[model samples]
Target: MTLAVPSSAVAVPSLRVLPLRPGALLLELVGLEETLSLYDAFQQSPVAGVLEIVPAARTLMIAYDPLSLDQAELLQAVAARLGKKRSVGVTETVDIPVHYDGEDIADVAELLGCSTSEVVRRHTEAEYTVAFTGFAPGFAYLSAPGAELAVPRRKSPRTVVPAGSVGLAGEFSGVYPKASPGGWQLIGRTPLAMFDLARDPATLLRPGLRVRFHDIARSSMHAVEKTAVVAKPRAGVPSDIGNGIEILSSGLPVLMQDLGRAHMAAQGVSLSGALDHGNFKLANRIVGNRPGTPALEIAPAGFSFKAIGRGVVAFTGAPAATSVTSANGDVASVDFNTPIALDDGDVVALQSPLSGTRSYLAMRGGFVVEPVLGSVATDTLAQIGAVALGAGTQLAVNSENVKKPVLPGEQPAFAMPKADEIVTLDIYLGPRTDWFTNEAVESFLSQSWRVTPQSSRVGIRLSGEPLERLDRNELPSEATLRGALQVPASGQPVLFLSDHPLTGGYPVIANVAAHHLDLAGQIPVGAHIRFNALNAFTHIDFVASDPQ
Candidate 1:
């Protein structure tokens, strides 16, 4: 539905507010410029519980803590903010050198019915503004008024597009920060690195930044490419003594993670952390470490670590068989939620979990690692943070500070599903439920869907009856979140996880409830999942989401 813009600066534009999740709201606005203007205003004076305010093509996503402020109060404040006009601040201009030798340059020229050189001329002459950042870290969508070089995305997305590859789709242009899957029409390539985690400000082109492309000779392109190097790990003063465990063998994509990078969705970063928060916190507390401490997120199993110095440690999430072998050859099995006293040269081994997909291991003082963007969490989708764990890795820990007494009765175990179990999750209908047919929505809730093996930290793909759409119009890319049930052209649904992309161009029928988000993350491959729709607010039978 379209709304008219206000004629007076003090008049508010008609806005449509939709519940994104329990504590988040998706505000559909007039357009990009208005979205950015409101985004700037909110940044200048943010609400108390507002954690992240993400601006998309035509919507603004506000994430908040429900405990700090109620949704009604927050919506009132937003309405008041929209009542007044806000100015977009002045932005910086960045001239980028481009090489007109992309694989699809000639194809794009033919599609536009122009010579390749003229296509290059049109691209170079236009000045583009960074409308928003999404898809991947450092990938900025460039937009300009009265754009003349618009093109559709490729029918088939390439499995991998090289870093610095410039592409265009619809009314926007972007350069891929790293090698990843994409559907944009490749027109040229740039040598400038778009994102560097080692850099103080990771993204070179931020939102509202003006950018212009200039063509360079193929010979000079080599020099420009040489300037783009991976950011080196920054050296830092050790905050703790270099005492910790040495990895004998890291089982199945182990990673060091804390509560991931939050409040940075505008920068194309996802809130990726531990899959199961309940288990992560329980493990930390068991070892006398504070919550948010760096811990080893162990994927289903075969991990081994040797203690360099004696320390107290505990494991949680996904019940698994753990064994501890002392330096004297005394081996004993350990249980979950129980702190294990490790002596020097003690080796700990973890087998595959009988249930669940991942586990958490925490030490008394927490693991010490170089943090990127104030987090040590590894976002597999964005490829941010420390590299995946492997053999021959040596990590340090902080000083064994205040050790809290653990009550015997306080040892709590997290629930995990048995092998090939069916998991039922509650969901709340959209932001975009109207996009799908009524039958499709019914199929989504009633049908039994199996988690495909293609699932990962990015999202869980489910194969079932195709969900037919009510409208065939293309959806503009918008901000996405964990548990978003996005359906693409294939009609299959993909439930997003912790490391989901910041934005997507698919229609989301429903979002898994906030309370069951962590449970959604634990679903293993081949597991059957049934969606039970619930009333959005009243927690009663879900007859209709919004009566109005």
Candidate 2:
């Protein structure tokens, strides 16, 4: 009934990997024989933007952020050094302790047709090396799930696999690093924290680092118990920074965000922030602030804030009805579009969105919160920023006696994108477009695609003709970027969003441009969409117009 295969036994086809764009994509030869060689290659002449060299069972996965360079350019640099020889660093390895007890542990034993102890023996037989860092922040897929023990992920996924879980799926064995929904066949758990926000390097270890996990007594689970504590460090930030905003009433899912953490992809940190960036910045502008300044990305049923004095504020993208009811119940419909003045005790709240799917509410003198790794972006998937702005969390208020901006700029007005009945998204043909049949690509380009209900900040699921893969490519998990078009085994093509994982095993067909982000953001569940392809010259021409 199951289609899992043993790693060692799987017939090899000589690793038929090909260069997609070679300019931005990187291919690393991993597996114990030569992967570790890249260590010296990196040390002798380190390449800029060469994020990290990960080592795993005879291979390595190289990771990078394409934002630093276009996909085509990044891959060329990698191909240029295809045959270079290097040495694995003779560095000391860290010993991590793990408890072998997971729901799927027994299932894995049966698949291997061996005793559970034998499974553990094979797993710990050799000192495993981290091939590359990916999946999520702090999640490292190590190379040691013994060929026999290697198995595919569960047919159905677990919604919340806890942090520290040790799992085996395919030839890969990894620790969850953080609590998340996963389908990896879990075999055990580790006490060692794979990802610690308070800890330096954020991700304790990276690719190529030699790691040997020791099995500890189950009783030690409590001895090495993990405690999650999020607190502001006692460092000297500006004394004027107040304890953030006081939430009178949150209209909907309102949370704080920032530009996000970059350069951590090799260590598995995802860029998590407001889903609709256009609206995010527009909200910042409404508050008399530069775009990209941290702002409250409010959704429909916008949140209400009562500031102590008049503060700069702005709103934009996904235009929604907004109102500020004074302490005396004087309602300001704000037809004039400026961030209405708010003195002490003034209360403001937004009505349900009239057109767009989301709204942004930004305040001038950006909310001063404890910056983590020089960023306030919350890795919602990793549970990393000031406790995800729960009901009672106070926003940090910058108290430098800020002077309010002169009469707010003429309220920049915009309407919601055209959706509901039919949606049109312009796209570039693709990175892995060749993996699919030409007919499938045609179907993707011309057919009507509907946004599925399972969409989230991570990715948008679509209901359409399954874009079938022409050939089964042994995809080496590579770094995935925002707007990546991925057609998984499920046949549906998913458009990854802001919170997507740093790398994935899927074949990304194409990437959505930044300018079209706002348009894609407003496509709600059940929305029907049509895809259109554009050239580089045409892309420039399309953005020539302000509206998408």
Candidate 3:
């Protein structure tokens, strides 16, 4: 299966699969450098269900959907062809203009021991190849910026870094694309929208694309908010059964979501959408939203909506102490345990919940949201959706509404998080679980790990013993996802959540199961935890996912 790289055509590794239980092992060619980068895989063998790929300086880390093909069947297919890796591609050049006027520009220049202009010179001089995309929507991690601009990350990360801000640290350089908390040294800012939800592709930069910075005039910077409304939704019933409630008094933090945005991982876009996929589905089933249909996923203080249409919406996740009022002024409290119907402008509002952190609002008919990248899932990470939920975001109603689920008010049967055991965690042996000492490993499985204050949609930093690694001191970046409990060389074990970076320099000791995924969603800060043996939970075979 070892074929020489053909200059005209990108090399493709023969499809070699590996078995690993509900998942498959994918052995494909990856480019490492300009002459041997693995960026060619995404361009040539563009197959469906490609989850995420993290291309570093010398290797490409891949994580695929396991439910489609079991791990056992996949390993056997890939074993023979796992020989000398061939080059996937060279690189494509793309010049980017920068302002070199970030708040940390001078500080970064001082660290590099040169004039601020020299910092910009060395940066803008040599071309930077995109390594990978993750952390946020369209956040491209460019390859090494040569040695002159090499430096460590800031000791204390800033609380907020503005969008389009250019940064450099160690071997990587990237544009912020969006405002967020980060530790990279800022060097400049860009005028272009690195990540745009309204854009056809969303993210323009991809791994292997060569990039350079060009300074632009400050006055040229302006907002790129082209609101393209796809009016008149396709003819179909919005959902099943009863009349749906209309949004009456929405208090910020309301969003329409589905499974999420995928395929754009290389562009650094996040798979943003519902916090709890299970509840999102359950609520939809109650009101009868088809898979991939748009449902409202709201926060603790949920918004109030009035029902002008006939349909029921179920609040499935974290018990939002919700109350709904009839048009006749009959106010009644509705619990998350059941589904309720609203008849024409009936107002519904979710007061703060005592136990749960988030809530789901599923209409019998899915929201009439415009689809982007084959989904209406709003990616807060990449910022894709009909629009960000705000005081003025409006949703259109469909004329030929769809049928609701089997039952509108009928409560669906399901599994929920245990009210007790604040310190218990389900586990599965990980790819690098053997790297740690038996004691360190034992400590990891037995000790109570506390949720640190530094927790968010991105990741939850835990306060626990340093799980010492006896083998190599560092690990090359690889595919990280939800419930990925990764241990960096620093000894702290971080539980990566929904918005965790696609690739990270850490060792994942275990991955939480899909059934238990909800438990990790709103793990209150300061809560304690300990790991349970992987065998403690039964393996519910996951079926292959179908595109909606």
User: Which candidate ranks first by lDDT, i.e. highest?
Assistant: 1
Which sequence of candidate numbers ranks them by lDDT, best first? Answer: 1, 2, 3
Better of 2 and 3 by TM-score: 2
The candidate, 1 or 2, that scores higher on lDDT is: 1
TM-score of each: 0.91, 0.81, 0.75
Error of 2 at 25 (Å): 3.5
Give one digit per residue, the lDDT tens place, for model 2 in 1-548. Answer: 11121223222111212222223333334444444454445556666765654433333344455567554454344433333465545866878787888788888889888888887887766577676677777788777534466677898999988888888877778888767889899888887888776788778778667788778888888532344434342232334663334566765556567667666666777767777776676566555666666766665565676655555555665666667777788877663245655665676666666555666666667776676765676655556664455345555556453454534555433446544668677666555677788888888888898888788777889988888789786566766667778889987988887778777788877666556665776766777878777732111000011112
Candidate 3, residues 134-189: lDDT per residue as tens digits? 66657777875454777777889899887878887667788877778888998877
Cα-based RMSD of candidate 2: 8.5
Better model by lDDT: candidate 2 vs candidate 3: 2
Residue 222 of model 3: what lDDT? 63
RMSD list, candidates in order: 4.4, 8.5, 7.6
Query: How far is 255's C-alpha from truth in model 3 (Å)?
Result: 3.0
Q: Write the per-residue lDDT of candidate 1 for residues 1-548, one digit (tens) a residue.
A: 23233344354555677767778778877787677777877867778988888778887888889999998788767755764555556768999899888888888888889988988898999999888899988889998767577888899999988888999888888998888899999887887888876576888888778999999877776422222232122232243464578889865878888888887776788889888877788888887788898998998868999987778788888878999999999999988877888887999999988888888999878887877887888888887887887777777777556367542223434368654888999888887887888889889888989999899988999999999999889988888889999999999999999899898899888889988887888888888899988853221111112213
Give the residue spans of candidate 2 off by over 4 A: 1-44, 48-76, 102-110, 144-149, 155-160, 223-245, 335-337, 390-393, 399-415, 418-421, 472-476, 535-548
In candidate 1, the residue pairs with backbone N, CA or C atoms under 3 Å apart (3 or more residues apart, or in different chains) clash, namely none
lDDT of 1 at 79: 57
C-alpha displacement of 524 in model 3, angstroms? Answer: 4.8
